[model samples]
Target: MLWTTTETNETLAAQLSDELRVSAVMGQLLAQRDLPTVEAAEEFLRPRLAQLDNPFALKNLRAAVTRIEQAIEGKESVVVFGDYDVDGVTSTVQLVSMLRTLGLEPRFCVPLRLDEGYGLSHDAIDRIFDGDVPELFIALDCGTNAHEPIAYLRELGCDVIVVDHHQTKTEAPKGCIFVNPHVNDPEDAPWRDLCTAGLVFKLLHGLLKSRREAEDPRVEGIQLKDYLDLVAMGTIADLVPLHRENRILSWFGLRHLRANGRIGVRALAEVSGIDASQEMASSDISFKLAPRINASGRLADATLPINLLLSDDLEQCKGIAQELDAMNRERQGIERGIAAEAERRAADEFADEPGIVLFGEDWHPGVVGIVASRVSRRFHKPCVILGADGDETHGSGRSVATVNLVEVFQRCTDLLGHWGGHPMAAGVSLPTANVKAFTARYLESLKALYPAGLPEPSLRLSTWLEVEDLEEGLLDELDRLHPFGQGNAEPSFGVRGVVLEEAPHAFGEGNFRFRMPAVNGSRTGVAGIAWRMHGVPEVGQPIDIAVRFSWNYWRNSRYPQVTLIDWKPSGEN
Candidate 1:
């Protein structure tokens, strides 16, 4: 596979190393990440809650907080309407928890994905209200583009606060206290890239600050740090960039996750076979925890996970966690079956095109997004996977770095109904009649933009490392940047010229494994595993490899190992 390596400035790295009294490799890694100045590097290395920007920086934060405060103080009813995804569920949990701390019982509703779709629907509001509508409604992770809903809420004498991160129109929701950052220039906004959970944390921060300033003793003992566990789950699950407060939240939240403070999260870890008692990382949340929480929303009602998150009873938490675990298993089976067929069809259907769009009547709508992402990554091109029901079709697309799925979908809006998302991923709906036309337009856009066809994938290398550097000590030094994801990816190092200790061989999974001597001249030779790899070379094959250095960990034990990204014959560099 092709790769791109970042050039290192030896002189600058040396300067940083001498000043910081760290390894040159650590200095270079920090430099490559653009934390050049001493203060910047220091802050990046040691993110503190004190360093978080003022919560009032979020647009409309004060207004939202004041409205909530009034509702609580007056004993008025409140409702939390949120999306069905992990972000929505977590944000709902966060906000509801804070409201309870303020001494108000808040009613919260999560839409059934199959029935209500995304955002605040009139019917959903009606269901949540029963007869007497809440005095105030807070919409989490959705409702920014909900003009009609906002209007309907006003008619019903309800105030609305939209805490969302999705893109919104210039006009904004009329009279609704809009809190999204997308309406303004995020280039200078500290809170722009935060996911809804992060936004909720900021809102809580503002409320706590105002309440404490006025000498409110009730808000005194609330640590706020205890809630970081939920915030971290949502941040990592939602794929928000791990920068600024997100990094701090996730970094500490990971600690909270490992401590397993929340009964629900602890039960989830146990049911999912994750030893959460040990230190947890971002991948654990992404792979183990997020999927279980998301499965509730995808395959069934999202309220299950939210209830689990809110519950304090161990028995109830365990039961919900098991149910979600089962749902996740069901979701996986469905996703695997769909992905297999989708890949086969793509191999034939999109053999020559720069992109692909496919739909099936029997496909599960909830799992199509995952398959779309998988198809896009597999083919390394933009892909749209649709689930058809009667005459209407809803589809989601995942884009490569070369193409913006949201932008492309917008250009082809003439063929779509409701559509919106970020640059890398998007959702769309239209009549099944226009599916073919939409597919054609989508391919046309891709062909025009990437006329040369899909470009070869590039494995980005952060730095080159000798096998000797794969020591337990280096892991500690590199871990100054923890909870790696999105904007802050775990560094992938290039290791040149190592002879295989034995013939490479495939395991039960597609991963290839072998051992080689530790170039650091240590007594013990280090081992490596290359996932999703095929075609093994003979013993003593001199090879240069790209690897991510980390601990090969088990219960109460850890040893150094390199996870290979790619490899070539020796001397290729």
Candidate 2:
């Protein structure tokens, strides 16, 4: 969709430059986020971890901490139960490491994606109870909405502390202590957008603070910043918003990650061939690190990633990293095949529907969510991809940014046997008989919620750039907005009336290439790639383009480049 900014808004942005006494570029960027006052502007520019709320702000914080402290004092066997994803693995690592430092016996456990299914399950809990680990289970990133299994655990006298960030239903599990932001007060802290790792980090902060107050200097030098790398890895991998506390955590975590990297991180980097000297970005974590970690759960046991993260041995870490890398390749093969099949089915089946819901009896539950996400993005609709096994059917949902999917599930609570997640992403399980009913109800609820036209996608441009401003200095100035992600995105500028002086270089025999343009009496090069646009651009045609200044850094190579977002040939001027 074509987008044009308001002249009044542009004037206000210009006025902000004068008020803040900063460059117009920076002022306009802040103005885009709707920063009204200078105080808010300062806070936005410099997010302090100290400015973050106390960890005790969560409900039942004292109860949860007291349980952990009792376990530490008694030397009771504690098991840190986690999920397969980055957020889950990191939470396990963070909590396990902290518990060990506090003189507690903590072992980690994770359910396999294919074999055991998602979150806290009755079978896994039963097995743990059999192991007889003093009935202490601290679940991270899971177990928030696990009503049945949690109640079963309670019957077994097992205590569960659920540290999660997923939205909860009104009828939640009767947990030992549920520390979720969505519960209690909504206005407690804006950091509720944090991933599971962020929630676990807050809990650890409380534990550490208590230990330090009791004259434990051993906890003094233990900087939680050391684990910011894991926090950054998990937060970015899970695709959490890089805003507020998440932004602060990631910004600082990325810096430390580059400097004092972990063995598993270094090994994964070596396998992926990423240099530590170069700064790590969110894309690196999402594409490279996260995939390898998640591959463990897809093809093998989820314990592999947990082992890799918590291991202190270098050789073992390298072995696990290489194993995960191998699994990632296998996972890619499966994901591609499944995604292709899923797309075909989606196209054939849901051609008329505004929302998509597809189920296959033979589909693997391990990778359904990722496939669903791909299909959802391709179709630009909310999707629920289901995989059936025996009488139980599991599904994952990915929604467009406009819809509140969790709310839809809340409305269709009767059809869903179990459901929990954020607004845009969710996981569900139900009997095979209920798939059609749930899908129909879900679509109906969505239609009722947003009867109006869906909002058109817009490219938020930071500035309107003329050909004259395509200088090395201007690109350098743009680099000030570092550590970009959801809240803080890479700055995009519009270059209007620019002629494509030459045919684009179609690189790698794929859907991307660079364009050579002649503007302002000079030959200025810009990188242009049609991600899905295979048709060639007409030579010598003037087009309105959205572009971002980017740097391609590799071994012994560094250069400025522009990533083309969208371009349409223009008749104006």
Candidate 3:
């Protein structure tokens, strides 16, 4: 059963004329989704980018900038070590671009998702040390909890600066310079949901500011706004909150995306077919750019996406973007196949278990997090998915709404080799032999917290309405809820007593579509489709639906597509 909140029109929604303006259906949609308050409704209706906070406000930012400035002055070899995901890749690009403009050859290294897992590894550090190692290592999007690796680097007489946003363990890593937002007292920082790139952007901004203070004209022509494109992509793709600082970044980032975007980004936009002229919403990047960029690490090598982003050649970028697009298609197929197998295996392994833990001998580590996330959503339980190699296993954890994955891992610390992450997601390394024990102990820990079954997730619909209130202006207002992600979600509303105009139409083989009418004089035709939604609801059935309004710009024409949330028969059947 779905848990739902009451719907009441906020004053803003109530302002619309009952007859000529937005219909009751539209008002209810707004209220149900909690977009009724003037401020919230304004945020949902219009996101202005001018309000983002300056990056200089972060603590220890001055110290980080001082160290980088010193390194640049002394011509010290600098290495930027970022993660393998979109956040890591973008952080690498953002920093490297800035450092290069200063005539310093800033070398970069990203660990292989399959080989090095996530974050700084002793193996990666060893490789860097064996080669022309940098005197200073700047770790972005990761390395806050890399106690062992950071210690090893310090032993080698290297200075390490961590600019990450992940939640840290109770005992922080020692010896390396840590600039995590989670550090110190919780009351100080205004926001905690900063993704990795956002942190790096601030550090870079501070460095530039320090240079300007020194009367260095070298900072000129370095457009920080140009880099917001990367920041916005990483922040949204990382699923951080899109309020306050994040909202400001993404708001302007969309403008940069529409104008003066890098060749690679432009190429990506081309194939994705997101018109630069139109207002690109957060949904556009989540469904389009993120998957394409992530497919590199998922199927083959992450270097492809990184190289594509760093490339200046339009033809080369276009080729690579198209290649990544194809690779993403292939990844979708692989994910589907592996997910089905993993589900079957989970069903057998977790028959009576309170939590889920599963591993495959040759499972692709690159895809384990994706699999784990899928399982967690599917089972409504905390899940840990592992990929084995000889005696050691590398894995990623994704928790449900009620679970604290980092704390769970902290309790099982004795069995883990290297571990770190946030409340919702974590990564760990354990002996293959310890997997069963860890799973059992973790399950027991969960029992202590939640003795009963997990509660049904509440779908916080923004508003409620009837079928007759659809209009173009209301759809326009929906664009304001952008950068919709982890903290602030896209508005979803429900409509009741909607009569299906025909049997849900089946297209794209199994993709389902539906048609319905409007209350206006004109017969307002609409179709809603769910992938593989064919043969679900019978034709002419009266059903209640939860939906988000969207504009699908296809073939030079724009029309509404209601992203189906949930639909059930309206009457007691």
Candidate 4:
């Protein structure tokens, strides 16, 4: 793989370091992120709640608040329909909880992934509404382009409010208070990329502010901060860029998550083996918490996690957490079998193709997205993994950094039934008989887009650091840039002239553990681990290595750990 380094502005870095009293490395990182002025860097480092823009600034938010107020005043029958993912579950819980506090016990439901498919579907609406139609219908995390379902609700004499973040396809739904920033707000708005949970948080903030202005006693003690845990989960899980208001929400949200104030989260964390007493990082949410929450949606009804989050009972939450964990384990086993098969198929069939399109007759539809992601990364090409869903093949597509799945899908729209998502990831469904045509069209489109062939895979180093610079001070400085995600990625440094203390200890499959010689006259060496390495580097020989530095919390103690990404003989770039 090719290794590249970001161009650094030394003058700006030095100026930031001097003015902000931060280490030179921190300043360099700030400059790399385009934080031009000291104020911008300072705000990025210390994101304050005061920095969040007014929720009322979002278009249609006031109308949504007014409609919700009418529901509260009349004690109208309310129903909140959400998707079957982390963002959707958390958004549903947050809005329903807040509405309950304001004197309305809202009925909440999430679409069953296997039965009703995704978003605001007529089948899902029918199942949720059954015989009783809600007076006020609120759709979270979906319904941006769900004109038919939104119209169906209107026909039932229901007022609709859709708080979504998905990009609109064709046109926006009519006759509803739609609050999607990507559609109605400015491109540079700080909250433009907020997920459904964050949007719901903003909605609640608006409702609370208006209620307080009206001297309502019920919302007096509603602490919005208490809901940040959910916001952080949704924001990080949904993979939105962590900048501006998103950074502020997630930065504080991780702290609130670590506090474990909510009984359900505390219980879920316990089952997930997360120590709530320590600093909660984005990886904890991405790898641990998010997967368990998503597992219920994939294998069963997503309402279980919503119920878990909203429940106040400790033992009940524990039972639900355990059930979700079991489902996740089941999901992992199913995913492993399918991924191994899909990888083999991609390598054998589409190794020379610009993209991969694989379909399995018996593959589980819910787990194909994860398999698509793994296959795409392993092959370094765009991939679409599909499973038999009735008469149609339905699944998801994952793209490499340089590819746009949405643009690619648009070229094949004639063969697709329904498809929509962001540039990097998307869901698609097409008739099973058309799968071959779609595959050919997908590959042809990719070739047309990139006539010179796809770009080679590469790893980018944030900046170079010396062995002496890998000290506690650097780690402390890195701490200020917590909760890294889509936009603000965790930095990986290129370190030169490193000699291992001893021969590395080989461990699990293609994995080994090594230690770097002591720096700054320290007694012990810095511990490091490398995964899936090609071969061990020579010991006692100076070499260049790319690594990510972080604290490894084990047995209730924290120690600096180095995660080796790549290494080569010194001077061999």
C-alpha local distance difference test of each model: 0.84, 0.77, 0.76, 0.91
Better of 1 and 2 by TM-score: 1
Candidates' RMSD to native: 1.9, 2.6, 3.1, 1.4
Off by over 4 Å in 3: 6-50, 185-188, 273-279, 507-510, 532-535
Give a tens-digit lDDT track for model 3, residues 482-505.
Answer: 567776676677788777667766
Q: Candidate 4, residues 411-465: lDDT per residue as tens digits?
A: 9999997676788888888899999999999999999988999999988999999
Backbone clash total for model 1 is 1
Report how far residue 97 has shifted in candidate 1, in Å.
0.7
User: In terms of TM-score, which candidate is strongest?
Assistant: 4
Better of 1 and 3 by lDDT: 1
Q: Using alpha carbons, what is the TM-score of model 4? A: 0.97
What's the residue-level lDDT of 133 in candidate 4? Answer: 93
Counted clashes in each candidate structure: 1, 0, 9, 0
Which sequence of candidate numbers ranks them by lDDT, best first?
Answer: 4, 1, 2, 3
**What is the per-residue lDDT of model 1 for residues 398-488, given as tens digits with 9 covering 90 to 100?**
8887687766776687888766677887777788999989999999887776677777778889887787777777888887878889889
Residue-level lDDT for 176 in candidate 4:
95
Which candidate tops lDDT? 4
